[model samples]
Target: MVPLRNQLLLGHAAEALPEVRDSELGDDTYVLDRLEQGRIAWLAGQDAGSKQAFAAADSRLAWEDEQAQYRLSRGLAQAGSLLTNDQTMAYRVPDYERTMLHHYLALNYLQRGDAEGALVEVRRANQVQEQALKTRADEVRAAKAQQEEGGDEQMRQQVSRGMPELDRLIGQVKNGFQNAYTFYFSGVLYEASGDLNDAWVDYQRGYQIAPDNLSLQVALLRLARLRGSPDELRETEKKLGRKAPPLVPSIAKNQGQLVVLFEDGLIPARREFFLPLPIATSGGDFRTFTVAVPYYDNRASDSGPLAVSVGNRHEQTSALVRLEALAAKDLQERLPGMLTRQALRLLSKEQLRRSAAKEGGDVGNILVGIFNTLSERADTRSWLTLPAQASSWQGSLPAGDIRLTLGAGSAMRELPLTIHAGQTTLVWVQRLGNRLTTRVMPL
Candidate 1:
């Protein structure tokens, strides 16, 4: 049997119930008192009491009017928070009504330096707006159409905003499917507005929704180009079942110097280098070997202030100089012999014991473990000095992207790095604890 209150709560559905027709508690005023008490409790910061009051009040309002009733209640609660005890009583006055009661409440809070409270009210108003706009089926459809049309109009307006290059870029983006194009253009707008993180999310979403679309592809391509690697493109290709672009052969050889030029931007999206490590030494052994170092370069925004890491293209070039170890050794000649032996024993037990007999092969599994450990430390915001070997020594390298971004402009470029003899000149081995746990691998 549906109670009269329940009937009112569910509007017409409950009203039709047999019990509702026979109930003496059908008086609307009694039910409205419960709702008023709830709103009053909420304004007084008694949330639990407010919730109970609200439930009772909700039993009297018709289901069709529930949303509107809630909106009104919300406005009154916000306004009540700003009112003095006397002003609060005035709010209970029957004749004093205002459409934007919540808006006024928010404004009062803001003026009183209660930004957080003001924001809460403002957000409630926005939610109410969304609710009102979405209640009707026809209105929902119309709103969606209007939203799409508005987006299109916004994109067109963006194109005509006087920047020819930006317009061209926008047009190129729009040549793709509608949803993908919209996301891509939105990303561009966010990027131009100095919101790179938001822009990146939009770009990623665009790519995710329509990987093969030209606009998404081109947008990703541009990001990859700016960030400095085709690795993302290649990885994304695998995910999307698309083929990666063919890897180009190296045309130049080592000239002894390896220059790894990275972007100065906040996210450092890509990295590029003209690493000129010599192919072979006088004894025919590779001298300054080169390996491509790949890492995810994320920026907070266009105005990034994070320090970007730039490591040696060849890992063997710099040995870890432990300050404690170095200081002890430097104090006396006798200490050097003991320290060297200790270091070798540690390295042999830790790294060499795990090193395989294979001369050169994939060491991806080991690298993964090492990286995971390092990442864990990083996650804890702890500083760590971990060792890595030359890339050439690792047999199986974990295939990933090496990102690079433009030094000054917007063009981010991505180049593929592999373990092929000509392309990889350097390798780094990971030393876990005191021993080499993995064989050397190219960056």
Candidate 2:
């Protein structure tokens, strides 16, 4: 099961959409089916279909029956009645991936020249982001409160002793679970659709979260100019250290605007790491045990930028988001709960083994201990098909042909694109190493 899951994940990471689409495994696996359909639909430029499919899946998960099933499955897994393997674990919808779905749907609507629909998707994306943030915060708070109320000083000390190691592990990674890229795109869409007020709000929100993002800074400056706020515009210019460019004309007005989105590589995969925990027994002695925990490996893709040419001008794509960082932060945020659960599980197993030793001598104790050890597998399930990173390049040009050159020297390839007046063109490029898949959606 682990190998199969890794294969599917690596396949998507390598942009093997065709192979995933033709697989028979998805017929029985719900997550696999959804992921495969998403890749196929997006790659085929069937945005409407992809949007509907993801929406339907989200609705289904929200249904009462599905909710009950999920709860039961999770309970059984935690109680040690079910295996900790991928198939038995309850599915978790990756928050970042869900947010990206809305972001992509907005692009889809824009491609169809439906500005209102695009706005709706942008609003939905923001809502999802806010909801995810609040939900995670509430869960963490509740967990901490429960621990404080139930645990004694010794237990608290034991937990605290592990903090330094955990902190060190987390410190190696950067960024958080928030999606500044989504906020940035939402701001851009809002501006394009003439909602300058909302555009300013999103731009400011994004900038607050990722202050180093120059593109978002440029967005705020453009909004300031549109709103005729000279003071704010000047403030933005000083911060930017240069004069800002003129606001991009509305793409819906027959102006040619090209937006290239590149989804490069695959997000970091979750792997298990075992940590030795010391549990204090009633005898005033400590029992040394091991618990398995999950962490993200810092493996990233090294795909070069796509050099885009709009007539005589040339620009390379710039990083829009580091998704692996978000993934790492998400795991880091959940570490507290993970540690608590593992500690409880280990304590329970130790109690059981001790009881068996008192009742049935050394032979029974050995058997029970072996059983506990065999059943103590770590939960390694995650949404594994998300992109490693996302990048974008946007420019306004005369209605004509545009050229995109990917790679360099002997491996260089040219992709020609055509744009019409008052049109916004979306060019999606997925790269896995040297392999590239490009699609164009002209709106």
Candidate 3:
């Protein structure tokens, strides 16, 4: 029941925010509560309050070192067997979803002016990305090895037949696990901490992946000048078609700057899809069967980037990352494992039916078959509370009071901001329809 409620909240986070805020659930009692409370606190501009909630949620979602060792041992123990006979498998959290939590915590730290803490979170997020990629590669290798050893030609053929459509969908994803937004934010933190060398490296990696991103290009140019790299600065300038702006002098002097990060809409949710294939049985008979699969539904959210006005100056936040793309890529990377597990499950059920027919009457076999078919279900779990997309904009503003407006006219909401020179301020905005939640964090 808690899982179902969590799914609902994740699928409709904007709609569910009000109810979650009204609930009496303690922050540490349940994972769902922690997730919801953290999001609510962040949206309400309570950066300090969200720390504990996010920390609790992170600890729960994390894969401990011992857990990985246990999983490895279990895999080795079950190796070379046709089927492990294990009916239930534990839920595996998606890597992108887990990385988002770390990314958000890093933002929370940045809002609180903890550069060192933010760097730690960024490093964790990067480690998660690396692990996810390695795990997927290993899964693909294992699936191929299993297919060769088991001589599951029919299963391999079925997977190949389904590849066309699946590959087409996978190809639509622009990026995978490495998030440009995380890289950009990390570069910002490094720059703020006066680590120009590390900042340049981060900016270079980010720009390599997202060359169209002006913010990254500018950052690279700034670092190039500071590090006395004329060639790199020239390359970046040529890519941008103009000279980049200088680093904020006040920020350099340790006064302060303002950074606005916006989480536009809800990320796409996972939905179940079915694919029917013909399976060859031991009796040389072919049976048409259906298997449940999961895919991303992109039409869930259509919210665009926000137009922000700080005092009288206006700038629109640029798209930094698309969670939908990353989610799709993650699914694609895990496709081999998904196909293998589904095929194995179907084969096990078929064997059960065959055995039941030999041991009992036709009525008993039919009952067993019915139960197996009814119990067949696809794994549809995901971190549903993630935003559809995230965008950011940063600028230098004098230390003083200012009015910030998101959107325009009746659709707009005005919030006050106070900036201090030589420091950093983070303004987070989440928009759902005409409703807006803004938080101002001074660092």
Please tell me which predicted candidate would have the highest TM-score against the true structure: 3
- Provide the TM-score for each candidate, comma-separated: 0.18, 0.78, 0.81
Per-model clash counts, in order, read: 54, 3, 12
Give the per-residue Cα lDDT of candidate 3 at 362: 100
List CA RMSD, all candidates. 34.7, 4.9, 5.0
Provide the lowest-lDDT 10-residue window in model 1: 377-386
Give the alpha carbon lDDT tens digit for every residue of 5-101 in model 1: 2332232321222332122233323443443344333333344654554444334433425567655754564333221111121112110001122
RMSD of 3: 5.0
Model 1 residue runs over 4 Å out of place are 1-181, 229-233, 237-443
Over 233-257, each residue of candidate 2 has an lDDT whose tens digit, in order, gives: 8987887776867765564355576
For model 3, what is the error of residue 321's alpha carbon versus the real structure, in angstroms, after optimal superposition?
Answer: 1.0
The 0-to-1 C-alpha lDDT of every candidate, in the order given, reads 0.30, 0.63, 0.66
Clashing pairs in 2: 254-421, 254-422, 255-422
**Which number leads on lDDT?**
3
